[model samples]
Target: MQRVAIVGPGGAGKSTFAQALGERTDLPVVHLDRFFWRPGWVETPRDEWRQRQSELFAGDRWIADGNYGGTFDDRFALADTVIIVARPRLACVVSAVGRSARFHGKAVQAAGCPERFQMVFYRWIWNYDRDSRPRLDIALARHDHLDVVELSTRMSMTHFLESISVR
Candidate 1:
């Protein structure tokens, strides 16, 4: 679908899925992390972040990935399709840890922001279902017009990706 938004916890493979989907659909892929984080992991100011997001959303076609809850509504409002990667917490944590190891000191998703493991990040991943899922649920409810796809497991995610046909 055009104007897709891929969202989930930190380690839910949002970037990977967005890349694959973009490849298949031939849509421009936008990684929110790249825009939200400046050098040295500094966050863009909230107002500036919103402005950047608005500019990104001005495009007619794109596959944007990341769970920047602050700007989620804006992105969701523009997206025709929303993909949620709802993997298990343990799986997410493990995936995050693995990503940190593999991409240590190198920018992976967020440009100029090298991957690093932190206890707080781990805790957030651990508590994502309890803390973030409810908020996401509310957002999804508010956006009933959007086509939402939830992949609750690795098998489901694989199947969903495999089922997509390039236009």
Candidate 2:
């Protein structure tokens, strides 16, 4: 599919999945986390963020991975397919902790935002499904015309990608 939008809670591997999908489909990949977070964990201004998102989504083919709550409509409007990586909470928590340990204080993107542990972030992950899913679902419901794929485990993501490779 062209113009894929990948979304999920932190540690859900949305970036990884976007890369894999981009490689398989020969689409450009955009990791929103890189642009959204400025150096030292600062956030890009809302107006700038939306403008950047618009430019990124204007592409003919792309795999953008991130959930910038306010820009769902922008991405969904241009995307032909939407994928949600909903791995289990425990798995997500463990993965996030490991990621922070590995990249702690190291700039992982052009924005120079280093990974760090924040109780607030963990809390968001812990309650993502119960708290954020409703909003996400509502957003998705607005784009019923787009193809939606729900992946809840690593195996499921793998299988989905493999299915694509086979095509």
Candidate 3:
């Protein structure tokens, strides 16, 4: 899995998994959040974001994590493997909220974006399966050529990591 792509609802540990996989494989890890948001949580312009993604994908090896569907094709096109982190909605919600709380008012690992409460953000995570899964499924189908792995639990994630070629 030289070029890996990871996607999942917010707080599904996509970033954490990507980091772990990158560490084991000695591949570069790109947290899409770092590039997607500007300071104060502003989003990058679409065109610029797409171009940035293209540049990120130009590398020979990396483990990139995020569900930036806008650039799914751009990343998936070059990815050898795509992982779907599939924690339950409740779990995802909890994790996301906790992460935000931990970084509240501080610079988020995601760029310089500051963390704060936003019901809309929490609501989206709450309803992600209903509202976002369909689109994610469609994107995955479009990239059926790549190897897909779904990790629904922590143990599964751990086992999958160990099974991969760890440096």
Candidate 4:
């Protein structure tokens, strides 16, 4: 049983990659956003978030997708591999804005909906450019020895998974 973690700046398609990997591996995938964000897009209490992460990491096999700095050490300690999806700044921002526009004014099926600006996608595109990249860099450096699969394109993502056959 291997615990895999996929982390990247917002709008880098981390969740999309995690979902595809979940379908391929048949393992439960946890989106850290669900644990960190409450309904209405409020930030969950730090203690509560840590507790939730601890519970999720208790499992022997799973995939976690997010770059929450608070629990980075804990998750890295439990992970067998880490996948980071990074793209150029402009690309990340454009994809983020487009996705937000696409999902806007729709009933959100997830536990949380994009809040006013933070969740608006375009705003996050800018926010991530300034903050998310630094957080991911810290996480990656802290776990330098972990098997890191770095992917930037959808084709590479698909090919990476296709190469791994779950027995």
Q: Give each model's clash number.
A: 0, 0, 0, 0
At residue 88, give the lDDT of candidate 3. 93
| Model 4 residue pairs with clashes | none
The candidate with the higher TM-score, 2 or 4, is: 2
Q: In candidate 3, what are the lDDT values of residues 41-122, reduced to their tens digit?
A: 8999999999999898898999898988777878888998989998998999999899889889887666677788888988
Segments of candidate 4 deviating more than 4 angstroms:
107-109, 112-130
Q: Write the per-residue lDDT of candidate 4 for residues 21-108, one digit (tens) a residue.
A: 9888887898887777777767878888888899988989999988786677889888989888876657777776676677775434
* Cα distance off (Å), candidate 1, residue 164: 1.5
- TM-score against truth, every candidate: 0.95, 0.95, 0.95, 0.84
Query: What are the per-residue Cα lDDT tens digits for candidate 1 across 83-128?
Result: 9998989999999999999988998767788988788998999999
Computed on alpha carbons, the lDDT of every model, listed in order, comes to: 0.88, 0.87, 0.87, 0.77
Error of 2 at 161 (Å): 0.6
Best-first order by lDDT: 1, 3, 2, 4
Please state the error at residue 15 of candidate 4 in Å: 1.2
Clashes of 2: 0
User: What is residue 31's positional error in candidate 1, in angstroms?
Assistant: 0.7
Write one digit per residue (lDDT tens) for candidate 2, span 81-135. 9999999998888888899899888877545777788889989999999988888
**Which window of ten consecutive residues has the lowest lDDT sum in model 1?**
108-117
Worst 10 residues of 2 by lDDT: 106-115
Q: Which candidate is the best by lDDT?
A: 1
